[model samples]
Target: MAGYVCPVGSSSPHARSNACPPGTFSNHLHLFDKSQCETCPARFVCTRGTGGKQKPPVPCPVGHYCPPGTKYPAQYKCAPGTWSNRTSLASEEECLPCPAGWFCVAGAHVPSGRCSPGHYCPDGTRTSTQFPCPAGTYSTRLGNGRVEDCIACPVGSYCTDGTSKPTLCPVGTYRKEQGAKVSEDCVPCPGGYHCPELGTVAPQACGAGRFSDPGSASCLSCLVGHYCADEITSREAMLLAMVCPAGLLCPEGQAVAPDANGNACPRGYYCPRGDIVRGSVWLLLFTILSSSGLCFWEARVESVLLLESLPALGCLIFLLWFP
Candidate 1:
């Protein structure tokens, strides 16, 4: 017999014969030697080999794989990122890959858990923390599986790597774009305004006679006449600006009100606006009145006056410009 035991059973007429046991296998033809049958190796199992090749067993099981044969009834575990829910698994292929948005450990039967917030875990990942939201990005939800799940930093704010919240842009700065990765992305506020608080999307307008250069830290008071009337862009809206009306000590950023008359013009000079200064008109008028012998130009002029029409004052004052 190829695999059967000495079926003749000691060659006695009364002796009985039987098939080979489940654990042993024999592969010879016409072999009656009892020693020919061999014990099965660990890598394979032998059973019901009456006269020829051994029968193949069913798949080992679902969860546990074939053991190294170190002992009986023992099983091996699946690798990381792969899992099995039952016992006696046949091969490594029997294990399932980790699902999306989740992770599996080396011996996990099901996914260990969902990916955490601010982190990501793609299908087949071995750990929950395999990836983190990168710099300039953030996430607030769990079970995120890809880099795309992380959102870009928002306008008027900044975000660091793996951040979950955005930080507001500081005062004196502003951001206009949808995604501002770092604090440096916040730009300086434009000129003529001031930023007064912690976060500023738009700067506050400076007070009249006050100005800020590109949202500087503080507002600077304007000196009267120091700012050119024709200049634009660099100038603040003079919404409440006041000009010294006539005959009072009024400087640029006047904080006090005019109360009474001040200095008057001398014969050779004239007072206009708030200054005592002489121009071509004063010289021309003085010569004309002196030659006419009228000398009527002399009057009890009290203070510098801003008049709509100075000629109405009867030569007491001469205005070169009305605008």
Candidate 2:
């Protein structure tokens, strides 16, 4: 006889709201209501049971599993910290750590990928292995891409990773302070001093009376007859007042005296002033005195002859003036 189906949850015949259709509830239909069903506890799938259930036994979906505890409606999830390449029909294994120099950002789900070049993480975020240090710079310490690893200037020179050593001024040059890592820091020779070569040493002075010019190898002497007053004070000043004053002839008799400028004439020489005639006369007397007796005798004969030759010569002789 035709009959009504059964209702959920009631064990009595009243639970059937209607008679089962030929195909309906033919499989394991253990639970009267679909709502009462649950997925297997995490690694097991549903299987046919004694009762006629809404669905036949089924396997878990790919990448996922149905655990043992429940039967139908719900699906189970993978265990925490565990993963599988494809859907899992069984329990999952724990994920492994990424290899060195690599990172696994998504934990169990994603694969490890290479770290970016110029950057490294030996132990994930805990340590770093930065790229190579630049030329002229070094990092004996760890380089985590931070500023601390960069080198700095030493006592006498400076830099900001711009160059290796604090630039050494060439041999004959100097810098005021440290951190000068370039040629620009090398200063020129000091006043009155000179340095043909460039470098870190203080400029040498063209000592007293010497003239030191820039770019020259050594100091030069002041011209003759000129004095180098305050010679040591300034070399360029050597040119000043270097000439002898006019009228103050650098006398021939005496070595030319280096005026107030420090000029020194040879000894036995005197620079006299006024008419050269008087000077000539004095020079003549000196010449005569220095001559031999024969020269004196000859000079005497000439004078006597001239006196006899003229009447005026007689007048001049009485005046004690004989030419």
Candidate 3:
């Protein structure tokens, strides 16, 4: 019998063709009987042969299952959001769920890329990119595992929704607070000062002859005889403006800081906008006359004596007016 065989040293009869069972196979061309068939090995799936010599069972692949007797892998693939990095998996339990800060698509052997910049991913994520960082925060690096990892917008900067990094507050504006969610959080430059560049933490004081108002980007120069004093604005109470010596004429920041705010007007002159200029005659007269503490008539007499020391008023006035 071509398709039949019996145990060795058997009796005269009882030989018949019997197929190998499912999940079992044999490749022996000359053998005794069904007892010679081999059971499928671990980490592999097997199917019965065509009642003849048979091939080896299929080995399991990474991220897939290969239970004994399994005819196809479709029934035991790693699900979406789960993955495996090793082969020879015997069951669905061998695949693990994606880890924090990473993602795994269907049948994934390793995590897809890490969470993208400007985004975050929690455990078992299937699409890490779909999760964005919250507003008022930003992420400059990849694989942020939680929302708390995103950085707050720094002083002089702002962050919108899903930002990758904070943006500098625009020029002529400043922000005192951190974690600004919008551009409007930056305040305009204040009066008596200017904001020359982006991300100004504080306004720069205007120099001589220049004045600014609230929300001004830069200082404006005044006309002749019209001095621009920070004192004319909200700084009137007392401005800590800097001024070089009357004739010393030093550059900014090099002016000797006689006081905390830098130099004040030198003797015999006043600095209207923190710059030296000749003192006003009327102002000098007023200071002497008002502060002498003398009676009205006494002050008037003192003023006349001071005036008498000068040249004749008529001729002096003629030259000044004509010139």
Candidate 4:
């Protein structure tokens, strides 16, 4: 036949050249039936041959796939991010990427699954090993199809695992450093400062003479009868209480004192209540002077003065008689 070739190793002259078999082909015309035909190998095909020559199998080209026993060029192409290697790949399923944590090079006979914890692999990767996710990025899943799978750490969160999602920084804590990988990377708000919410980059300082508890949202004024020293931290403010001097008067919510040392009673003044009021001092002085017979002049002075004066007048009369 014009388009047929004899099979290889056939000894009979009557054996006519025939069309190539599904898995085999010959390029030479008038070839002895005894001539050996070429067999298609995996991932390869032998679709065309001349009448007088043997044809070599052609490698399956890119964008097309050839299964074992294929006598013609493949009509199917590999799926995106997938590849096949070697001849005789029977199906598209045979063309696969290295499993999670591993990588497979082009034409690889076996997949590599040896990637370390911090590394990852994408589909159709040709390297024998995986590449690391870049800083500030992470991947928690295995067998990532591409670098795009690596996720960026959120503004308030941290990520460590190459194949995992990021974690949020806790309340009262902050992380200024980029690409923080763990909660430990977050710093606690300092004393006298407040970190009200999560992911704070810096703590907010309490206002002057004001204090806040740790992680407080707002600062508190010093309590009544209490004084907050300047620049005092929250912890110190809580323990501080203002005390008035022994002799001075102190009222609630007194911030500045006209005389912090206290108002002292004058030397001549007797402050019975420890206060310098004029009424108490006068009342005390009057009571003391009137009780004694020291007042000699006015009847309004007292009973004691009357008794003593009468006795003195009688004595004077007796003295006059004796004279």
The best candidate in terms of lDDT: 3
Q: Candidate 2, residues 61-171: lDDT per residue as tens digits?
A: 543454454344234443332333443355434233334454444323443344443343343322232333243343344223343344544433434332423445554
User: Model 4 misses residue 193 by how many Å?
Assistant: 0.6
Give lDDT tens digits, candidate 4, residues 46-82.
Answer: 6644223334667676434677657665555554335
Supply the TM-score for candidate 1: 0.48
Cα lDDT tens digits for candidate 1, 176-260: 6756777888887766666666556666666555655775755666544222122222334322333334434444553333444
The candidates, ranked best first by lDDT, are 3, 1, 4, 2
Model 3 over residues 168-231: C-alpha lDDT tens digits? 8888788888888888988887776777778888878876556666666676654222334443
Q: Scored by CA lDDT, what does every candidate get?
A: 0.56, 0.38, 0.60, 0.51
Query: Model 2 has how many clashing residue pairs?
Result: 50
Which candidate number maximizes TM-score? 3
TM-score of each: 0.48, 0.33, 0.50, 0.40
| Model 3: ten consecutive residues of lowest lDDT | 296-305
Q: Residue 278 lDDT in model 3?
A: 26
Ranking by TM-score: 3, 1, 4, 2
Candidate 1 residue 218 Cα shift, in angstroms, is 5.1
Error of 3 at 26 (Å): 14
Q: Show the lowest summed lDDT stretch of 10 residues, model 4.
A: 314-323
Per-residue error for 182 in candidate 3, Å, reads 1.8
